[model samples]
Target chain A: MEIVVCIKQVPDVPTVRMDRERMTIIREGVESVINPLDYIALEAALELRQKAGGHVCIITMGPVQSEVALREALAVGADQAILLTDPDFAGADTLATSHVLARAIQKIEPFPDLILCGMQTTDSDTGHVGPQIAEELGLPQVCGVNEIHREGKFLVVKRLSDGFVDTVKVTLPTLLTVTKGLCPVRDLPLGALEAAFSTKDVLEWNMTDLDLKKEEVGFAGSATQVRRLRTPPPRGSGDIIEGPPDVLVGHLLRRLEALSILDEEDEKK
Target chain B: MRLEPTMKQAVIRRSVRKFSERRLIAAAVEMDKTEQFPWDIAEEMAGLQYFGLEIPATYGGAGLDSVSTAIVIEEISKANAAMGLCISVHNGVAASPVYLFGNAEQHRRFLNPLAQGKKIGTFCLTEPNAGSDASALETNAIRDGGDYILNGNKVFVTNGGISGINLIFAKTRADGKDLGFSVFIVESEREGLEKGPIEDLMGMRGNPVCPLSLRDCRIPLENRLGDEGGGLKIALSTLGGGRLGIAAQALGIAQASLDASIKYAKERRQFGKAICDFGAIQDLLAEVGTRIEASRLLTHRACDLREKGKKYTMESAMAKVYASEIAVEATRVGVQIHGGYGYTKAYPIERFYRDAKVCEIYEGTSEIQRVVIARELLKG
Candidate 1:
């Protein structure tokens, strides 16, 4: 059995400086870090690989800079790392990024039985990429998975969803989205970090490695677009109406009636 | 790779201040209530790794940085102050001089085992008349056939009662002034050595605080920390770094006080609501949080500057003063928040409040920190 883990490199928000003059992300001299949620994915993957006889391979898609994230994975315990990096992959949205990763995983020869990814990226916060990848690969997927218990050929999981706990069972070939409910990744010992330095180098793959037509990958296949991103226009400043309990209640009712929010027989009815 | 410390450094700092692995300081706070001297705590601190913070790997130490050493002292002090002071002074005065000044043979004989946490050491600087005034110390180490016979009494010597090694500073000068001051490392088995009975104190009572005297005590020639007249400089540098660790201890005490206050406010009720719900209590809580943060930032900033290999004497002195004063004020406010319960021994606030005062007196007094800052600024 083999496992594939997807991770992303994101800017360390605390260290990332803003360029007020140009109004742009000042990447120069700023540090990039592995997305925190990726820790859970890596932890889960390593645990599974250790219990079952298998290798956990890490895959990340970005520019040359993304190697930092891959090296972090190796230092933590991933057996091998692959960097799906190229200039042409720039400006790819979650949908396009997922398709590229799906194609790349499919090309891993002895394909992995399971793929694990973080539930969300700190920078994007979109949370759409993992599900899109599962759909693209036609694999059964589980999200918000906190734990995975092995039962012969299948895997049973404890998952969290909308104020309820769901136990889902899935076959060998599947994908999972992990959240904080999962165990935190262990910090690597100094000896392990030194060993990682000697053993792991990013295996860079270009567009040709995925064996995908230009029209079917990168920004070309993506279906979503962000017309423009801006701060939500300031909600006209909030006002507090203060008085005794009865007077405050009367004032709140008048305001709600003005907005037709307290109308009788409405949604509450 | 980014410029920031690697994740290992960001997470697991080096182990500088530690106790011996062979000995563990049993954590029994109640036994210390009768002013019991924590000889076991000192031995346990040596066992845990605080005795030889920077004495290199070859010397059998973990060889961690100053920041990590400072953190260890801080954590230990949070549980007990006497234990923390014992640790800081041993490393600062006893082990530090030998590591910094002793020759290869001296280091091999003394520094090696001490760094490895096998033994304890003491710093003998203060005299009956001199406390902060190191230059005025009158201890005499007169030469006698390849050995120096030491005479004079040292007061308020930290770890004086339990240490196996004593790094004593005394005047070798013909005149009775600060000049010709020399440091000697004397073994505990030396003849003519006297340890005064433990002095009574309101705080840090769990550790022994006593006077150490040298009456015709002789030390080998090779035991001197440096040539005559270098002792004062050595003392200043060691204590300069020592102040940083003391500041960190103060920060921890303050944080623990604020933490206790926050916990009590959330649970205790007043005026029919959890006191924490009251705006006045909320304001008090906010002030406690704010001061704790400020204390930590100042303490760490001085420590970080020291780690960068910069001159931080003034910064360290300022941190020591601010953190010490803040610990007292914060613990006082903590007691106030607990109301009548705060003043009682039922809670640890009363103990914390008592422990916070001595930080201002030791190392260099808050008044001395002012002097150092003023001198530094004036010289600039």
Candidate 2:
């Protein structure tokens, strides 16, 4: 089995600041890390490859600095890393990003048997790239997958949708976006990073290498434009009610009734 | 000329910090309360090569540099000082001596398991009669053809209860002639070897510090680490490096204390405002913060010197003394900042207080470290 994991490097902050002028994230002065969900995706790919015995290749589209994230993946048992970096590939929205990713995936020799991605990135939170890439590549995809089991050439994945746990089995050559609980991320071995930095090779593909025209890749290729970006206003403080359990319950019930979250009759009962 | 860590070192610190925070912190408190070595966590850490920080990769070790190795110990110590002590002693004194002095056969036989963390290792030099003055040991190894019969009681053995391999230092006797000091590689399961009960300690209670006694424990000739009578040289050189590890561990404890103190100061309110608002509290925080930074610089300096293959005996001693002292001081201030709540078991500050004191005592006492520094200084 040949698996390809698509990952992104995002700011490590919980609540990211926005660059209002550029209508993007403010990455300056902040530490960049692999998107948490994307890490889960990488972990899932590694686990499957471990059981199936195949090569695990990781690909990411970002600036040159994004190579660090790919190097990190390589340090943690990934066989190969592909950095799709090009100045023309900047300012790509979900559409252009997935297009470039899909094109890059198609360029892989022997063609990947399985494609994996995070359900969403921490910074963007669009949750659109995975499905968009699946659509472009014309392959089946499952989003928000929490469990994956390998049965020969098929993959059985479990995910919670609405209120029910849905177990779906998909054949080879499919894309899946994994969330947390797929697998626990292992710590990188002590010398693995130094070895990767010194010895491992991360292949870099520019827009020209991917045969992506400028109009089809970066800002010009995007269907949606971010006209403005602003941080949401801070939430007001909530009242902290401290008392005995019954007293706390009474106060909560009265507040819920007053807020129309609960009926007065129900509160009385 | 550079003070900032390299890219690889920075990533290592980040990775180890994440692992420590996620896995070790919760287990640390539990281990302290139960006084049991967390074998499950040890297995997890073994997979990540925590046991083989400085061992070469060919030997199934992580083969990290001194700086990176120190960073790992520091981060783990920050999360759990007892485990930190376990790793520092194992890598610094036990496994390291084998790699530094043991032959190729010894490397294949002993270093493999120790580096892979298959068997925890210990450096048993502290006897009841010998502590700071390592030369006054009473343990003796008698020659008997192909094997040596060893008899000694080693007390305060770090990782004694859980260790699989122990490096025992003893006086070698052949035909009633004393052959100074020699080190023997003794397995824990060897006959006539017994482990006393784990010590009930005030801090670092998670580590099962116990006494190990050997009565007629026979060790093969091949188990000898170096040339007979080379024990003192190996001990001195090995403990030089071990002191740096202790320094890193102390730095971690100090840093943790500072972090807890800062967070507590900002949140703990007294006299109608956060205690951090007062000038006195600010002074304490500032002093501890600066001291922790200083300790880090000294530790990192020692790590840098060791990594560069430079002579770092005095530097390591200086680092060890300063870092350990600061660790005690930082935790003291941490408790002071937490006030009444700190005295209780409610906060980790009190545990830090207990754990930090041993850093000054173990590996080498602060007074002994000053002796080493002064000797080096006068020689220079």
Candidate 3:
């Protein structure tokens, strides 16, 4: 059995900056850190591999610098790091990124049995790639996975959403978007840290390794454009009308009536 | 030169404190009641190159500087403060005389073996009548045809009862002058030389600061450390370097007290709340933490100065005075924070308090340090 955990490198949240004039993020001088959410995903993948006796390979798609995030996974006990770095993959949105990542996953030497990712990236806050990639691979996708257990060849996983819990059995080749609530991760002990820093065998791959066309990566691959960017205006400040339930209800009714949004019978209750 | 402990030295220093190789202590609490200096522990320290601290590797010592010596003392002191002082007195105070003033042959014979820890050494400067006054020695070493007949009684001599070599200070013949002192490396096995049992003290009880008496004891002329009447100079310089070590010792004590205080304050709860959360307790905790850090920095800086071959006498004196006083204050507060539990020996704060007081008294008392500081200041 094999597992592929997707990870990313993002600037530390506190130090992140946006270039207002250029309509982009300010990367220079920002301290890049391994995405915290991705650590949960990596932890999930490692645990699954450990329990099932399988190999865990970390697959990531970004520029050349993305190799750093991949290396971090390797240091935290990942079996290998697969980096999909190419100029053609620049500016690729979630849909494009998922497609390229799926291609890279297929190109891995031993392939994979399952795919894992964070519920969302801290910077983007877009929860689209996990589902998109699962759709592209024709594998069943599980999001907000709080508990995953191995039962024979299939996996019993608990997915929680909208305050509802669903226990599902998914066959091999499944994807999960993990949340921080899923599990707490830890930094490896000091002795292991020295060994991790000394060990180097992370696999660095490019478009050519996946037999990808140059036009299908980087700037050429991205489809949709992010043109004008600005924050939505702030909501208005309103008075805090505190009172007994009857009084508050009466006041609310008058405000709603003034706005012409209340019906007469509804106010009696 | 920027001096730091080599990796091997750091490991060895820790090993001694960690009790890596052998059982240095027979039992944890026996040394105090029986003021018996463990020759085995001394041999182990010598084997590990701690006995001859600051003696270069070429001279058979671990070749550590004053700073490295302080670090070693700190680690050892964490486990046993008395043993820490024992090493400090032997290496830093007793050994400094020969290392600073001895000739090439003297270096080869006395320093090399002492540094190698093969032959334990002691410095005999304090007498029944003289404690800090270097020039007021009553011991005499008159020239008697190729030899100096030594006759003297020195008290409060550290490692006095146990050490193999004694750097004895005595007055040589002079024209009715203020004790023209000269230092000699006295062997314990020599006839008519005797050492008394350990002196009982309120704290640092384990170190056997006893007596070294030269009752008609004769020594070879070559045993003299440096030149004629240079004993005072050698003793002062050696003691000046030793002051930095006391500062480091005080630093360790203060750190332990501060750590114990924080741990106690956080755990011990008062009426409905943890004591640490209280405004008054919080202030004590913060002050203790900050002062401990500041003292550690100053102490280590003074140690670094000694290692760099730069003159740090005044700075070391200041650090010794400040850190020692801080130790007393810090440990007292640590006991106070314990709110009654800290007063007992069951916890370390009380010992830390008792230990803190000695740092002020020894290695040129806090008053002496101020004198040295003011003198240095006035000279400029």
- State which candidate has the highest lDDT: 2
lDDT of 2 by residue, B31-62 (tens): 88999899999998898899999998898888
lDDT of 1 by residue, B1-380 (tens): 13344433332232221222112223425425776665555554454355676566567664656655666666657666677777677666667778888889989989987775566777788787888788778888887778878999988867776777888888884334435788888887889888999878787776677898889997878878778778878887778777887887787678778888989999998788889898887887788778767766676777777778888888899889988988888898899999999988888888888888888888889999999989988997
> How well does candidate 2 match the true structure in TM-score terms?
0.91
Measured over the true interface residues after superposition, the C-alpha RMSD of each candidate is 7.3, 1.3, 13.0
Which lDDT values do the candidates have, in the order given? 0.76, 0.92, 0.75
Residue lDDT tens for model 3, B1-380: 33444433343343444462134333324565576667776665565566766676577665555555677677566556677777777778766677778888988888877777777677787888887666678889887788888898988877676688888888987444544678888888988689886777777677778887888888888988888788878877888777877787787778778878888988989898889899998899788788877776677788777767788888889888998898899989999999789987678777778777989987788898999999889988
Off by over 4 Å in 2: A147-159, A164-172, A191-195, A219-223, A236-269
Q: Which is the better candidate, 2 or 3, if ranked by DockQ?
A: 2
Sort every candidate by TM-score, greatest first.
2, 1, 3
Assess every candidate by TM-score: 0.61, 0.91, 0.57
Interface DockQ of each model: 0.04, 0.61, 0.02
lDDT (Cα, 0-100) at A63 in candidate 1? 83
Pairwise DockQ winner, candidates 1 and 2: 2
lDDT of 1: 0.76
Give the CA lDDT, 0 to 100, for residue B94 in model 3.
67
